[model samples]
Target: MHYLFWCKDNNTSTPQDMCWVSLRMREQHFPGHVLCWVSMRMRDHLFPSPWQRHDALRAEVGAQAGAADTARETSTALYPLIVRQGMDKYKVLEEWRAGSFGATCIVKEAVGDGRRFAVKKVECIDEHEANLALKEAMVLLNLQHPNICAYKEFFITWDNTISSLFLSLVMDVSDQGDLGGIVRLKRQLVKKMDETVIQMLLGQAIDVLVYIHKQKVLHRNLKPSNILLKDEDSFLLSDFVVETLAADEMKLKIRMDDECKLWMAPEALQFSYSEKSDVWSLGCVLLDMMTCSITNDAEVAALLQEIRLDPVCLENVLKTLVGKVGYSADLCQVLLQMLQIHPVQRATAIELMDVPYVKECLILVGSPLSGVKKTLPPGVSDELYEGGIEKALEFMQIYTDFEDAQISALRHLSWYIADQDGWLCIEEIIRLVVQAMKLHSDSLDIQLEGIWILRDLVSQALAHGLNEECFISNELITTLVRGMRSFLPNTGLLSQICSLMMMLSANEVAAELLGKAGVLQDTLKIMESSLENRELCLSCCGLLWSMAMTESHTRREWLVYAVPVIFNLVLKHLHDGQLVESACCSLWILCLKGCVVEEQTESISWALLESLHAHPQRPVLVKNACLALASLLRTSELAAFRVLVPVSGKNGIALIKEIYHLHSDDPEIVENMCLLFSEMAHYGDTRPEMLSQNMGPFMREIKVKFASTEEIVTLAESTLSKLET
Candidate 1:
C-alpha cells in the first residue's frame, strides 16, 4: 500500500519533517493547528471530494507513482513494527508519545481477541536499566485500581545490530484519548467542562492517586496526557512509567521538558516529593480542565507555568474560572487547596478524597472497582440527597468491597459527620463503618480512618446528650482491639484507637467490654512504649482516666503499672499544658482507685506539683493537679512532705496558693483547692508552708464566693479551721 501522509513542523521545511505520519498520530504529536500549503484553486482542482482532503491520501495501485518516492523519502512510520514471543505477536499501530529513549505505542493484539492496548517501547542503556524498568512496570501492574490503566504484560527485546536493548510494556487502553486531547478539543469548541464532569474526572483522578499512594507508589509525573479518558464521564490515570521512561530518556538526569514541568510541583523540580507533590500536579490538571475552553492550550500551559513560579497566581486562574459557566466555587476552593506552594499546606490524595464533592464525584462518575454505587432513593436523590452524609454512607455500602472507595468514603464521612452535624441514621452508618473496618483490616489507612470517624461520631453523640451505648458494640470494641493488635506501636493508629476508647469508656458496660477485649492492656502497653509521643501519651492518659472514672475496671492488677506511665508522661511533657492536665486527671483517678501506692508516691507528687508550677494559669491542669496532689497526700504522709519541698522556685504550698488565687473564680478549682489544703495539714511539714502562704484568707474568699456550693463551703470551713489552729 502506498500513502501520502503530509505533516508540517514549526522549525523545519523538509517534506519528511512532520508531527507524525498519519491521522491520530498527528493529534498525538502536534500541539498546534495543522496548516495546509496548497493554493485554493489548485487544491480544489486536484481533489474535489472531501475524502481526498483526509489526513492520509491512499493512492490506488500505480495510480500515483510519486507516492512510492514520498514513502521512501519519509521513513517515519513507527508502526507496522512487530513484537513476536514464541507463537504470539503484536502489531504496533501508532506511536502515542516519544522521548529520546522511549515511545508509547498503540498496539493491536493481531490475533484471537484482536483487541488493542498500549505498548511502551523503551531503549535501555543496559540490562540494569532494563531490570529497573521491569521492576517499575511490575509495581504499576500491582496498582490495579479501576481508574488506573492496568498493565497487560511486559517483555524484553534487543537490537543486535546496534547492541541496544528494548523493554516493551503492554497496558490497557481507554475508550477516549488522553485528558490533554479532551482539553484540546474543548479549547477548539470554546466550551468549558461542566462541574459535574469536572467532579467526575477529578474524583476519579483523586481516587486513583489515593489507591496508588497508599500502596507506596508515587506518580511523580502526573499530567493531562497521562490521564486517559475512558469516555465522557470516566477516565483512567495512565502513564505510571513516565518518570522512569523520562529518566532513561534523559540518560538518568531526571529532567522533564518545559512542557511537562508545567504540570510538575515546584518541590518536585528540586527532587522532593511526597503524596502532596502529586497533589500539586493534580491541581495543575484541575486548572487545565477548568480553563481549557476559554483559554488556548499555550495560554493554559503558561498559566500552569506561572503558578509553579507564583502559586498565588492560582487565584488569578480561579478568578477566571469563577467567571466561567459550569464551574463551582467549591471547585475553585479545592483547586487552591491542591496548589498550595508548601507541600505541607497542600492536601494529599486521601485528603482530597475526603472532600465531600470529590467523594460524590467518585461515586457518581468516578471509576468503581466492582459495579455502580447504590442509587439514592428517588425522593432522596431529588430532595434529600444534596451530597450529604447519606450518600457517603451509601458509597461505603455499595463499594464496600473496594478498598479505595471505602477509604474515600470513610474520609469523606469523617468530615461530613462534623460539617453536616449528625447523621439521621447514625446507627446504620456505624454498622457500615464497622463492617468496612473489619473487611479492610489489612489496610492501615482504612482502619485509621474508620477509628477516627467513629471517634467523631461518638464525640457528636456526647455533645448532643447521647450515650456510648448505641455507638459502642462488642463488635466495634473487638474490631478496635484487633486494629490495636494489628498495628502496634504505630503512634498515629494507637493514638486514634485510644481516643475512641477514651470516649467509649464512660459507660461501665462499654468500659468492661474494652477491659475484656484487652483494651486496657493495649493502652498500658502504648503508654509505656510511646511515653515520648505527647499526643499518644495524652490519649492513653485520657483513656485511663475514663476507665478509672467508670469504677468497674479500675482495680485490675495491670492498672497499677499505668500510674508510672502517667507520671513519665507528665515529666516528659511538663510544658505541654493539655498533656499535663490529662496526665494529672489520670493520676487523680488512679490514686482514688488505690492504684497509686506509696512506692510511686514521690514521682506522683513531683509530677503533680511541677505540673501545677509549669502551668499555673491552665485552669484544667491546675484543678486536676490539685485533685491528684490532694489524693496523694490523703494516702501518703510522705507525699504530703514531698509537696512542701520547694522545686522550681515553688513548693506544693506556694503552687497551691498561686493556683487558688489565680483560679479563685472557678468554684471547682476552689473545692479541689480546699481538698489539697486539708490533705496538706495532715502532714506537719506541709502545714506551715500552707499557713505561711496565707491559705486562711483564700479559704475565707472561697467560703464567701461559693457559700451556696455545699462541697466548696464544707471543704473551705474545714481547711480554715486546720490552717488557723
Candidate 2:
C-alpha cells in the first residue's frame, strides 16, 4: 500500500521534503484524518493506543524527505540491505529506517497474526539530528508510567549508524484530534472533560511524577499540552523533552512558550526544584482542575492575588469548588491540605494516601483499617446514642452523620452556657471535649476545639470552685504538646496551651511537668518574639506570673530569666491594662516570695519600685508593688531594701494623691493604701522613717473627710498607731 500522509511542522518549513512512504496495509483501513504511524521497532509501533506509537511515527514520517536519501545512503553503509521475511523481522525493519529518532510511515504496519509485514523506509538529515532522536528514544525507553507512551524497540539498520525506534501505536486521530483542534470541535465537551476526565489525567500526571521521584528522575517539561487524555482510564503523560537527575540537575531546559510558565511552581521558575517542588506544580494542576472557569493570566493573577492576600481563605476556594463540581467535602479537604504553601506541609503521594477520600480507592480494593483508638478519660463515655457524657460527646464529633447539624447545635449551646454564666455544665463540657479529642485525634481542628473547650472548663472550674488539680495529668500535657508540634512552626495555639499550663501551676506534679517540658523556654521565646502579639504576650506574662506564684523552691532560678523579660515587656506595652496588671501581679508574687539574688537584687528592686511610680492606673499595681517592697525589706538587708524604701514611699504618696484627686469614690483604694503603709511600718525595716513623715499629712486629709470616707479614715488611724509603735 502507498500513502501520502501530509503534515506541516507548523514550527518548521520543509514542505517539499515531506515523506511519502509505502507499506503493507492488509489488516486496517486507511481512513482520511486517521493517522497510521509506522515505526521500525515492533515494540515502539505495536504496544498500545496511549503510546501514540503510530501517530508520533506518522508525524515524523511526514517530516523532511529531501534529506531522506542521505539517511538511506548512511543506513546502507552501516549494514547490508537484507529483506528476509519472518527470519529478518528485526533486520529488515532496521534496514528500512536508520539514523533517525524514529520515522513515521503514513500506512503503518499492524503486527497482526501471519500477515505480510513491510517496513517503511525513512531517515534524518544529519548525525546531530539523529542524536536528538536518540536522546528522545533513550528518554522514552527509560520512562515507565501508566500515563506515558510505552517505548517498545529500537532499530539500528546495519547500514551507516542509522537508528529508529518502534513505539506502541495510539489512536489514528486523537480523542478529538490534538488539543488545539479539540478546543475548537467540542467546547462544552472539552470543558466537561477538563472538569472531570482531565483531572484524572492530571492526577495520572502527578502519579507519573511520583514514579519519577521514586526513580530519582525529573520530567522538567510539564504542561497541559503534554498531558493527553483519551478517556477516563486512558490518558498519557507525554512529551519528555527535558529529563534530568532530580537531585543533581541545577539547570532546566527553558521554553519560549508563555502558557507553560503559568502552571510552573514558583520554585521551579527559579530552577530550585525537588520532588516536593513538583507537588507545588501538582497543586496548580489541582487548582486548574477545581476551577475550570479560569485559564488565562489575568484570571490566574486575580485569583492568585486573592490567595496571596489572605491565604487562610484557601478553604473558601475549595468550598467554592465543591459548590461547582459536587465533589465530597472530605475530598476538598484533602486537596486543600495538599496545596498548603509550605512544601513540607504539602502532601506526598504516600501522605496523600492518608487522606480519607484518597483512601476510598484503596477501600474499593479492600476494607479500610479501623480508626485508631486514642485514650479517653474515665468520666468520658463512647456511647453516642446514650445520655450523660455520651450524648454530650456527639456535639464534638467532627465528621459524623450529624457533624454539620452538631456544629450549629454546639455553637448555640456554647453561647447559651457562656451567656447564662452557668457553671454546672462545666463537667459535662469537659467530658464532651475529651471525647472529641479522642474521636478526632488526628484532626487539627478537633484538637484546637479541645483546647478551646479546656479553656472554658478552666474558667468555669475557677468560678465554680472546682479543684484546679483535677484536670492535671500526663495525659493532658501530652495532648497539648502533641497538638502543638503536630503542625509545623506555631499555629497560634501555643497561647492556649500556656494558659492551660498556667492553671495547672497550682498543682505540684503538673507544674513540674510543665517546667521540665521546657514550657518556660517556650513561653519566654514567645514573649521575646511576641512583644507585638498582644494576646500571646499577655498569656506568656500570665504563665510566668503563675509559675512564680506557685511558691516552689525552684521559682528563684526561673525568675532569673522571667523577671527581666517581664519588666521590659511592661515598659514597652504599658497601655494594655491586662499586661500592666499581670506585670504588677507577677512582681507582687516574686516579691512576696522574696527571691534572694545578691548580684541582681538592687537593680530588680529599683525597676519594680519605678514601675509602681511610673504607672499608677490600676490599684492592683500599687497594692502588689507595696507588698513586693515590704517583702524585700523584711527578707533582705541589701541595697534593694534601702533603695526600694524611699521609692515605695514616694510612689505610695503619688498613688494616694492620684486617688484623692481622681478616684475618691473608690474607698477600697484608700483602705488598701492605709493597710499597705501599716504593713510597711511593722514589716519594713528601712521605710519606717519615710512612712512616719508621710503618715501625718495622709491622716490629716482622711480626718477632715472622715464622714465622707469613714472606712479609709479608720484604716488611716490604725496605720498611725502602727507608725507610733
What C-alpha lDDT values do all the predictions have?
A: 0.69, 0.50
Q: What are the clashing pairs of model 1? A: none
Which one wins on lDDT?
Answer: 1
Runs in model 2 lying further than 4 Å from the true structure: 1-392, 395-432, 435-443, 461-473, 484-491, 503-521, 553-556, 636-725
Best by TM-score: 1
Per-residue lDDT of model 1, residues 349-444, tens digit only: 787766766666766752442234333333432322357677887777777666777777787778778776764566888888888887666778
Candidate 1 lands at a TM-score of: 0.46
lDDT of 1: 0.69
Q: Tell me how far the alpha carbon of residue 693 in candidate 1 is from the true structure, in angstroms, after superposition.
A: 4.5
TM-score of 2: 0.39
lDDT for each residue of candidate 2 in 375-480, tens digit (9 for 90 to 100): 3344333333344333444545533322233333344445555555535556556555554453344555566656776777677778778765566554465456
